[model samples]
Each structure stands twice: as C-alpha cells, then as structure tokens.
Target: MTDFITRFAPSPTGPLHLGHAYSAMLCHDMARTAQGRFLLRMEDTDLQRSKPEWDALIREDLTWLGLHWDAPVLRQSEQISSYDLYLDQLAEHDLLYPCSCSRADIRAALSAPQEGHPHEVYPGTCKARPISDRNQGDALRLHLDRALVMLADDLPSFQETGGTHKGTHQIDPDQAQEQIGDVVLTRKGERMIAYFLASAIDDATQGITHVIRGEDLFDFTAIQVILLTLLNLSVPTYHHHRLIRDENGKRLAKRDDARAISTYRNDGRTPSDIRRMVGL
Candidate 1:
C-alpha cells in the first residue's frame, strides 16, 4: 500500500461551500493519483454548533461531487477522551496552564498597546495561572516559553510542497513566542480542543503522511508541528494549496450559501462543472 495518506477534515457547522469542494476534490485527486488513501473526518468538536443534519448534508454533498473516502470515517466528537489524554501528556510536561481570558479581554489587552508588546498575539493575561488552578470552565493554553525550552536544541520543522512558501521551514522561537504567543488548547468549559491541537493529534494517530489544505492555515503549521514533536509523533508533509475565492476575491466561508456546492448542484451543475470551476 502507498504511504500517501491524507484527509479532508471539515466542521459540520454550515453548508459545504465551493471552497470545501475544491479542497476535498484536491485531496481526493491527489490520493487517487498516488494510489493512496484519502480519509474523511468530521471536525464536529464544537458541540454547541455541530449538528447531525449538517454532518449528513456535508457527506451528501461530497458524495454528490463523486468523491469517496475509505471505510469507518472518523469523527472528532467521538474522540474527546483520546484528545484529553494528549492534553494530560502536555500537562505532565507543565506545558499547559488554565486561561480564563475571554476574547473581549484579549482584544482589550491588545488594543491598549504597551511598550515592546506584540499587538496581535495573546498578552499572557493568565500565563501565571498554574495548571493546578484549572477549574471546570477555564481554557487551557500552552506555555510556549517552557515548551520551546524543552525543545531548545531540536525545534520542529516541516517541508512545504505547495503554496508560495514552498520550502523546508524551521520553527523560529522568536516568531512563535512573539507572534503566536500562548495559544489556547481547549475552550472555556466546553471541553472542546482547539483546531490546531486536535488536527495535529489526529494527523499523527491516523498515520497521515501529507496534510493538504488551504494556504491560510500555513502560518499555524509551526504550532502544530511543535505539538507533534513534543508528543513524539510523526510530522506530515504539508501542501497548502491556493484557496478558491469569489469574484470579489474574498475567500469563501460557510455563510456564503450562494457559493455552496449544494447550491451549484441544485442549479444543475455537474461534477465536471465543479472541477472546471475550481480549475482542477
């Protein structure tokens, strides 16, 4: 069997837009071309927003696009306990701490600029909070300083096979510390793991060899790589393909129902039409 395993993981919180179709078709085509496996994963970890109807609709849209995945599709909602184990592993290293800061709090901190302080990144409002103080409703954030110190001599890096930044890139501690800061791993009281952490863990667990997704996520790859390296998991090659944007050049979001795959299909567009529209 080929080792070029990949996945098209999408949250079932909204309709499957054209952007989703492009990404799914790209992954499907790549795996088929390599005679490898293309898997489907429902990132339904957002318990509040995730719905069974949306999940069904997403699968239906993908199937209608003539795309197919292997048996036993994985769902993130069912893997919470497994993710909790990973979080515990990080906690064992003292890399995680409780964060009670809300988005508004973070925004206010960033807006009120302090000298030599990074504006866009988290200001470490709860960095001093110990893990032992973690309550039922507090979010968990990775202490990048300690995590980087743990891997001082061996910072994680990955090879990019696609996108404008095509090359072997290493994680720069300074950029990660200043720009990315201490990122939350779990939401407040939700028990929902962050996208980067869960996706990284899932990629390793599923034996994914290549991560094919939009270039918008390229910047966040380093943090994921760091997590994988910390857990001693295999890091996958990433291909951040160009996004399929609308006529106004805005990248498609779930709310863009007019550009949804189902809408196009309902308008009498065929699978070939989709491939052509996406320039595949």
Candidate 2:
C-alpha cells in the first residue's frame, strides 16, 4: 500500500534560506512517513542565475537536516533535448505556433479598455494570427485548440492536496482559454525552458507521483496540467503547501539574506533550530 513517490526540486539560483528549509523538510518527511521514494533534482535550468555552488549547498543543507533521496540527483539543465522533442511533438499535433508578443505588449494589451470589463484577460490577440506571419521577435506558443476541448470534455486530471490525489475532474475549459489562451510553450531566446514545460517533462521522466510545492504557483498548475495532456505525459498529483512568510507576512526568498541558512549556521544554529524557526 505504499507506491508513493516525491521529489524535492530546488533551483540553484541562491542559497537556501528558512523558506527553502521548510519546503525541503516538509516534502522529504512526508515521503519518508509514507515509506515512499524521495528524490532530489537540481532545477538549474536558468544558466544565467544558477550556480553549481548553490546546488551543492542545497544538497549539503538538506542532508544536514537528515533527509535523503533514493537516486543520484537529476538536473533540469541536462534535459534540454527531452524538452525540445516534446515541443516538436506538440507542434506535430498542430497544438503549437509562433508568437511575437513581448511582456510589455501583453500587459498593455490586457490594460486596454474593453466592453465594460472590469479586469483584463489574455485577449488572445494572436489566437487567429497566422503562424506564417514572421516570428520576428515572437516566441513559439502552444495553441489552445484542444484546451477548451479537454476541459469541456472532462479532461482526466487531478490535484494533490498535501497527499495522494483522488478522482478525475471536469475542469472548466473557459478558464484556460481566458487565463492562458495559448501562452508560450517554448521560447527561442530563453535559456530556461518556460517553467510549465520543464516541470511537466521532468515530473513525467522522473516517475514523480506527486508534485508538492508552494501554493503561490497554483494558478500556473493549469498550464502544466494542460501541457501534460499535450505532451502525452502523465500528470502528477499536485500539492501546493502554505508558504513560509517573514515577520512582515511577506513571502521569503533569497532576497531575504538575513534568513539564509548560512547566516543561521554562522550564528551556531543547529538542525533542530531550523525545524523550530520555520515552524516545521
């Protein structure tokens, strides 16, 4: 009764802080308690920001917290070809196209006045735009032709709420069409494969049974779920945990160096102190 699988995937962009410690400890402990397989993966896809030193430190820090993984650590940077193949496959399904919309273009488009609408939705200016139209400054996007179909037709998907998921859901397809509307599935210039693609592919390739991460990313899960279906990859259950916040009730990040593990270590804080500090 224990075929659970979990992964602690940490980006190697910065030193692990209290927030990271909390996520790591929580994920690893839950996996262990279920007698499941726990794995480690370095999300060092951002070549510009990811440092090998930081990756090494995360491994050391998690180990210091008495957590272990079942296999050699997998790194996202090593799986580019795998991602590329999936993008091409989706295009073969006629589900992807090229787009030239920049961030400013998108934000500005959404800001424009529209039929008494209070807020902006991704108006899909490029939805009907032909792909042959020069991809000048544009990036490749996964067309949501089936996004509405999958959701309306009762797409087989599940959400993990801190543990194993249950039952298939008939997602509202309009949400994807409105919120996503063929968002960029692959960009030509970005070193990091967009988060949605990288995560969906990694989870499938790694046999990850559950994806437990911060809830702030819950909105983005729909995109990943959509991608999983597009790529013919298995959708892992998702469990978005509560984030650890600072005294100001703001989310913790590397920007908060004062809460860095190194800073705590320098002040002679022990492993047990970490669990307490982060309220684990």
Which candidate number would show the highest TM-score if scored against the true structure? Answer: 1
User: For each candidate, what is the lDDT?
Assistant: 0.85, 0.72
Q: What value does the lDDT take at residue 80 in candidate 2?
A: 64
Clashes of each: 0, 3
- Report residue 227 deviation for candidate 1 (angstroms): 0.5
**Tens digit per residue, CA lDDT, model 2, 1-280:** 4578888888888889888888888888889888998889887766767898999888888888788999999988887667888877876766666666675443333221222233334456676665566354566666786555644555755665752333444455766667666666555555336665787788898889888887666666777787887667898888878788888788787778898888888789999999998887
TM-score of 2: 0.86
What is the total number of backbone clashes in candidate 1? 0
lDDT of 1 by residue, 1-280 (tens): 6889999999898899888899999999999999999999988777878899999999999999999998578998998878888888999999999888775543233121222343357788889999999887778888999999999998888999997889999999999987788877885565667777888899999999999998877877888899999999999999999988889888788889998888998999999999999998
lDDT (Cα, 0-100) at 204 in candidate 1: 96
Instruction: List candidate 2 stretches off by more than 4 Å.
Output: 103-121, 129-137, 150-152, 163-169
In model 2, the Cα lDDT at residue 135 comes to 57
